[model samples]
Target: MALSDIACRNAHKSDKAKDGKAFKLFDDKGLFLLVKPTESGWGKWWRFKYRFDGKEKQLSLGTYPEVSLGQAREKRDEARKLVAAMIDPGENRKAVKEARADSFANSFEVIAREWGSKKVQTWDEKNNRSKRMLERNIFPWLGAKPIADILPKDILASLRRIEERGTIETAHRTLQICGQVFRYAVATGRVDRDITQDLKGALPPAKGEHFAAITEPKEAAELLRAIDSYQGSLPALCALKLAPLVFVRPGELRAMQWQDVNLETAEWRYLVTKTNVQHIVPLSRQALAILLELQPLTGHGRYVFPSERTPSGIRCMSENTLNAALKRLGYGKDKMTVHGFRAMARTILDEVLGVRPDFIEHQLAHAVRDPNGRAYNRTAHLPERHKMMQQWADYLDALKQGAQVIQFPRQA
Candidate 1:
């Protein structure tokens, strides 16, 4: 039967003899309230039903007098607005609740696993190192927490834990990796902001140190003589000889392929150079001779310096090979090393051979500023460089022959 506001308010709980039956009451309007007994011993609670999207939908507003007639009327009116807009209010409410729960439930460990699979496929060696560090250090601490809930304080605390081990460089690298992960989360709409953003200047600054190198030309000569005498593999010997002339990084030299070199043209083309640009190194006659000697052995392989352990394939030589060779010659921490060849060439070529510094810098693949405020290209000074490389090689031969050296005129 239809009910008045006073009747709805005056409704009382029925006894257990009623077997917890529910009573339905309707107002002067079509609005209805239901008072249903709980399975528990508690008294009855209330719910309301309304029409939405041309279909009847029930919305649980609240329990009885606890939700008075005025409040119930307000809720029913709001639900009518949603229904008029063709929305199922109950379903929307449930969706919103589920979304919130999911936001809180996703853990960092879940994200890390996804990151690892994606990284192995996409990232290079440097990025692979970052992934491993995160797996070993950061993941253990914060991997199980929702990425959204991880605050700046939490990241800082985690970094502090790494710093406690006196591995400041590692702490810095970990922070960088964490920042990348947070940025990834932001891109995917999983998190709003990267908390690692403000972490700049937060960690201890890395101490300045020079690269370990042999700078003196005399020391470099001694190292070279030692390498010539060393009884290592022919690939190692060829690398030692080429190291001084090319002055490329040890990594780049070790990774050189047979396709990059053209002995007939005396040109070594670095298609995949460190700067992500193609570089052409004009080979001197001496360099050509060195390669001709190595050709019979390594010419069949793809790599110029294939691993001795591998058959019919090229693997990168160990980074320590050249250094170990130098150590055997009694050169200690302060003396000449493999990488010092670059410094030795740059110094002697400029100071002793009197080649133009700009040409030297360009040949070294170092970035040089053009007069027109443009960037320098790898082949920018190729004509002068061709002659310069020949002269440089001849100058080294003269030094090896104990010729009395005279310094050349410097470039203006």
Candidate 2:
């Protein structure tokens, strides 16, 4: 007998059925309500059974009450029409669900997040800047779109918006990072190829530029003297003083952890986030002295330069702390920057101090490879780098005293 509205609404498990047992109420043409006993009363689902290709199959219409008797019948009729045409409605529904799942899995944002998560240990975006970049720039545009569905024009449109905001360099970097994500998607079989490959030269080329620094002895002397008198928080003061001594990247300096420093060995060993390589910086006596002074203040904290402004005291010095301190010392962004310390050290060491370029490059944590094309071990030239570091510190002291330092020709 076909199910009626009154029967459907008042449906219950068989009175003689044991606890947890289930029973079905048949309507006709393979449609039925499978009602299972529940703790409260009964649970039910609307089911449609049929045969396709000489095999029996079942499909779920929905649950009771939510899917009423009339609604279930309407769905049963539609599904019957599909079965009459020799289509297996069950298989058709499965295919539709699988396609939706595949599209969501292959979405650009999903793939990009997966790629970024794999790079968390090595990524230089210490503050989740890379994730924010996607959320702000790329995700808003192509995030939900499947990787294969995204054309080169879609990417260009996103990048052009970044460029229009006058962050031409950021737009270029965003493109590069996106290309990494697309290639990751391709490798994972989500897409057959990286669509970003076709976007070569689609955006403006990045400008060739370098950070500003006082490389000349006289100007550097003036800047060093200015830093000596520029007062700030203890963390900022120590970072500004030590910036020129070790000359590591600004991020590397600020993120310096207490555990990474070995005062006994006069070395600061840590992973280079950008290159994902271990780097050892031989600490000069001057550098060691600055650290020793700060030790009594911040040695107990997680970061050597804990941000004074934060309540947690867990985070390192802010990104702008050193640059802002430099500004207070009369060094504008065009005149000098915190990152300019690396350039200052590289230039002065190779040109004025006549240091070996390899040693300077290695100390700068740059890639210095062997003739065989393999990168030199991070500990490469440890002995020589130690001597060079001490000598460089001594030379800087001489320059601070306004001594005349001779500039030698750079090596070929």
Strongest candidate by TM-score? 2
**TM-score against native, each model:** 0.61, 0.74
TM-score of 1: 0.61
Could you give candidate 1's per-residue lDDT for residues 1-412 as a string of tens digits?
A: 5555676655544342256566666663346666555666444344557666577667777876788778777887776787768777788789989986786456666665566556433233332456668877877888878998888888888888888998888888789778768777777777888889888888898674334676555655566667678787888888878888888777677777788898888889885344666777889999888888988888898778776677665465656776676677786546766767778889888887788999988888887897898888777889888888888888777666666667788865
Worst 10-residue stretch by lDDT in candidate 1? 119-128
CA RMSD per model (angstroms): 13.4, 5.3
lDDT of 1 at 405: 64
Model 2, 42-89: lDDT tens digits are: 888999999899988889999999999888999999999999998889
Error of 2 at 349 (Å): 1.4
Q: Report backbone clashes per prediction.
A: 1, 0
